[model samples]
Target: MLKRCGRRYIVGAIRTYAKDIRFGPEARGLLLKGVDIMANAVSATLGPRGRNVLIEQLMISPRITKDGITVANNVQLEDRRCNMGAQLLRQTTSNTNNEVGDGTTTATILAKGMASQGLEVIRQGQVNVHALREGMLEASRVVCEELQSMSQIVETIGEVEAVATIALNGDKRLSDMIGDAILKLGEGGVFLLKESKCLNDELKVQEGVTLPEGFVSPLFANQGNGNRVEYSNVLLLATLANIERLDEILPALELAKSKEQPLLIIANDISADVVKALVMNQLRNCLRVCAVKAPSHGSEQRDQMQDLALAMGANLLENATGLSAIEAEDLGVVSEVIVDSSSTHLLHPRIHNEDQVHARVQHIRALMEEAITDEEVDKLNERMGRLFGYLATIYVGGANELEVSEKKDRLNDALHAVHGAISDGIVPGGGTAYLRCIPALESLAPSETPEHQIGRDIVRNSLRLPCYTIARNAGVNPDEVIRQVLEGSGNFGYDAAAGQFCDLKERGIVDPTGALRSAMSEAAGIASLLATTEVLITEERIRPKVPRNQVTKDLAGLIGM
Candidate 1:
């Protein structure tokens, strides 16, 4: 019998590997070494005092950053197997950063320590993987309860700023901007990112809405008189038809031209001939119209187009095999259309039917009240925002391209962090949140058997490494700082920025509970996976290579030598 991933094997893929495989100690050792290598690379940038890593680009200027994701992403190891192993662990950090924001460094460090420590118990081969897994999970359950018990409510704008500040590694300017933006946007309001208008270290947020779709040609840009064209009563025509043929789109164009209305066509594609005609007609000042490809492709994208159409009282057409009738009642209305090179903006369009909009809103709210998990709530939030309040944009600026790029990444982290804090309660940042769970973790020690004890102890103590790194990176001794904090009140921890120990929450250094929990779960899960992995069969590592003599002959033949 042979093991198969699903029902079949991929073509040109390794099937049964008797060779090119590492097992037991050798495989486990490689995994641990990979974790260690990556951990050491990122440990330097763990706290507010954490320094940036400078990486030189081949054809451009160098990049310097303290962002853990940036460092992890830039790494490429010589050993492919080791690199793959490190990447698997890095996925834990990636998800944490993507989902809740922040804690990439903490997540990586926790994973390294757990996998390193858990390997010892796993090597004994006395405790089953299931048992170790159970012990870890139970410890997590306890830690989570402790986190809830210690969480601080985030109800004000200041608290939101605090969370964003900590996540951005203490960027006060960025933090203040994020806090103000979130407060101004209020509930269900969107926060979008845009490039800076000027090369100055300034952060600005404007009230605006954008769709992923944009206009096809700049020629139709409503730059009437070199001023922003306030194009109104624009029809949003969504269809799957290729309106390239003159007759198909001619009716719609003629109808809009007659009514003195602008037509904003959204379709899979329009004929080049049609686009030329539209541009020429607009140039002659006889018509105002632009044809842009519908955002997204395929069925899902078409459905989104239909949804937008329905919301705007526009007619949606499908399977239009020939020229179709264009009706005035099928047209949609927008308050204004602002076109830029990047995207087209449609501002505050009315639904026209207030009673119906209110009823639909109440129904969606009911469904949302029953929704759980981030994905469900996110869907509803987006739906509500699209129907009612529109999304806003924040333009992050800096003195240079590099600075703006880095600031954008930092602002993204801050944005998500602020959102997470608003949705969930806050916990003390700077590692104090994890350390606070130790007493609870240890409380389970008395009931633990020897096998469970080893796993449980690792989980308990590994939590301190994050704080240790935070303190050490701050130019202080972690051991002394930890000792002092543990001796003092539960809330107190080492603040490397201030170069002293203090209460983390009181000083406005806090994290969202959701981010912390997501990171912890991801770290523990990956560590368990690494510890339990006993064999490594790298198909890529065993691929046959072409001989140099053959390659040389091929090159010589090409040159007619």
Candidate 2:
């Protein structure tokens, strides 16, 4: 009987070992599923026309916008399995965005494709664990090569337009306008260009623009003690000196009244008598006032002051003797006085012809407006919907040019937008560009080789965690979700190929937390793979050996029982 029992025990142990080994396949499948899901999600937003799907799901309170980073950052996933994958994906996306100003979607797609293809080789029982690693390295090399081949040098404004059009998916008008704006701005000046129909209007120049010495109220009327006032159609003129006081108000008021124009008082300070006289004249309602402090003598201070003046109101003036003097000279009735310390001499306001720069600016503004339109934006969405594509630019310039820095910054911002779009859209990359490379990794997969198989199993198991999480959050059966994702028959929430989401429907309707979940899963997978073999072995061996006996153990010890 004892012999029989020993045989049974041995059989049971063998069965348990078999069960453990079987788990390897399941784990591997899960990892592949996660890689596919995330890859597809990122690839959905590759081109310039890529659409941001998550923005649509946002509540009415938080305005929705089709931006990938926002969507990816916002996704929420219920399952812990996908957390690492999602996190790694997001990190990769973010890194790509920060580095190139574009191509985040492509990078994400590449990563997922690489991981999936690597796993396939292991599954095929061809390659060993090292072979899979080698394959991934080669895959990365290919992706980089492809990216380099696609990247074009943008040397002229025309080249910029071409690139923009490509990124924007052939929006000619939109591309033209953006190009025009860059060309019009050139390198040296700031121009206030109006935006029309999403396009920028012609640059409006403020001649002899002056800056205040220090920050002060936007409403100050001519060195006066007058009460605070408001007005419509008030012209603002900025100056550097403190001149006319209460004595200047009446004369200035008389001249202003003669023109039957509403009055605005602007100065550093005013005399009390002037304030009373202006009130008695019933000119208070006709007036709006702003007082700006003078700026220090320096280019930086001047620039800061000029920006402030522009923010207040248009029509900036330099130096003026006093309100009384301005009135006597009939100097435009002091529509609005702005004080600044940077001006060397007084300036007379002059009218600008919008027609001069109007065509150029207006054209650009129109393009931007058109690009953002429903139809145009949709086209962009379509182009971006493709998998495993990249729009990249390498900006090469001398390190010292401020213009280069500025251009680089703008480019980076645009690139960041592309990344954000991809994260939100959640599409796959290039139909698994690493497909051809799988055979190399298959040679690394082991059949009876336990150690090799263990590595493959670890990677496979890690990938599945994301799939489980995605399934749970989407409220789908985890097993069914896993199978469908792996088979490429269904999507988690958004369509990678369409760059649209049935769940979101509108722009800015994605769950950023879901993206985070995917990223976290990827991270965990990496951590597991990189951890020391000894650590993994310890984790596998450690087991619960004791049962609850808290009360009895303490009591028995106290009684020396």
Candidate 3:
């Protein structure tokens, strides 16, 4: 029987074939080559002295950036096998960026060093590759512990500036702006970056709560005013119920219309018919109303809705039954609400339970302290921001669009780095923290197996690559710099930008401990995976046809041309 498959046909086709495959050293070598290329490109943007990379865009002007993840993301190899290897390294940087926000370059450089060394050890046939990979991971864990132990809390704005400065590659003005925002907001504050219309950077702050949710339909927005909706003295119905039927909240809509007030419904969902009914009432001027899908999902949705309802002085409706029984006393009120396609903002309004809101904020802060994963911590921070905190935005300005884009990227990096420093504390910068942990890694399992020992050695040596690269980029001898750093104690390291040796903190050079640790752990993880890779499989590359004349002699004669 013939069957349709995608855009092609199949006649009892069940078999599959490998397009390309390589085994042993050949596969590993090509992958390593790709890793080398990507790492080399990114490492050039590693430290205070790091150089900017110019990236060509599809239609717009090229981008000039010193961001490591940006450079790593733009690299593509011509060799398929090599590209596969580069992709693996790219994942390492991507993971670091997502988790820590500012360690992609450090992660890439470390992964490259470890993978290259592990491959060399494998080629010698002296140790078990699996055992070596295990040792590398174990060493990585120990180094992470050491880094945590060495971290210093960022108590003052100066410390915050230091972390931001390193992330921004010594842009002190931008770093100071981030520091000021953090200072003004205190802990758990939320601020964002935006492009400025003016050529001078600016900062704006307001009393409001922001949610990553908006109107259910554009029809709900003010007509012909883009996808934006605004209401004054609004009534809010917060619920987890999925509103498929209009009658579920018709009583509340009537109450809103009678009171001559705009109504906003925040719920898990709103079906098409329900949205249509709401939009019709709004269009006919019978009622000013809008429905918004609740922020987040699952338990998070429940928690956020509850918090939002509390802040808006309303009680949360849990199900369709609760929605159907909605009363004036059950709904909440806010001074004003402004919503767009992407987000909703509740301006300074009413607080039904001020003490409870304070209690919830404390609870979230406590949860943040115990949150094990970055995802958990981030969610908790968002909750804190929505519950009760300052909201600020930094408007980045530049001479041109490309310049603004580049500065925005740098500001984003600085912002993340500062937040990381606040949460996880700061460490000696310029890779000093990684090097300081080498002693702990070396001392681990003094009587381990040969393969394990080799694995540990590979990771131990790879940890120094970040500092080495930083010095090399600064036009200094990296080996000498590493030697001097090892000879000194605690937070003592090279200042690549100044080409001097001193305590990193004294030089106002420090890294967010969390980002630095993420860099180490993620790099080691990817390197171990590459170390044990004995087989590589990838799709065959298809080349485009070469251009040629379309008309042959026979065709031309037939056409009488």
> Which numbered prediction scores highest in lDDT against the true structure?
3
Report residue 115 deviation for candidate 1 (angstroms): 1.8
Greater lDDT among 1 and 3 belongs to 3
Tell me how candidate 3 scores on lDDT.
Answer: 0.84
> How many angstroms is residue 337 displaced in model 3 relative to the true structure, after the best TM-score fit?
8.7
Question: What TM-score quantifies how close candidate 2 is to the native fold?
Answer: 0.38
lDDT tens per residue, model 3, 208-299: 77888878888878844667998889998999988889888888888898899999888898899999988888889889998889988898
Each candidate: how many clashes? 1, 121, 0
What is the per-residue lDDT of model 1 for residues 183-258, given as tens digits with 9 covering 90 to 100? 7778445555668677644434444345566667778776766433347757656677777676787777777878
Candidates sorted by lDDT, descending order?
A: 3, 1, 2
**Residue 440, model 2: Cα distance from true site in angstroms:** 17
Q: Is candidate 2 or candidate 3 better by TM-score?
A: 3
- Report the number of the highest-TM-score candidate: 3
Against the true structure, what is each candidate's TM-score? 0.74, 0.38, 0.74
What are the RMSDs of all candidates, in order?
8.0, 19.0, 8.2
1-561: candidate 2 lDDT, tens digit per residue = 999999999986765554222134455555445545655554444443344343333223332323344445544343333444466556666654444334444445445644554455556664455644433333333333332332222345554454444344344564455555456544222222122232222323233333323223322333335323334444443344353455545555565566666554444444455555555455345533333344444553443334333333333334454443553232322223334322221133333333523443344335434463334432332222110011111322423333233333333334333333333322222121122222333445354554344544343343344334333334446565444445442112332334433322122122122232233233333433322111111012223334359887666555434
- lDDT for each of the candidates? 0.73, 0.39, 0.84
> Which whole-number lDDT from 0 to 100 does residue 96 have in model 3?
89
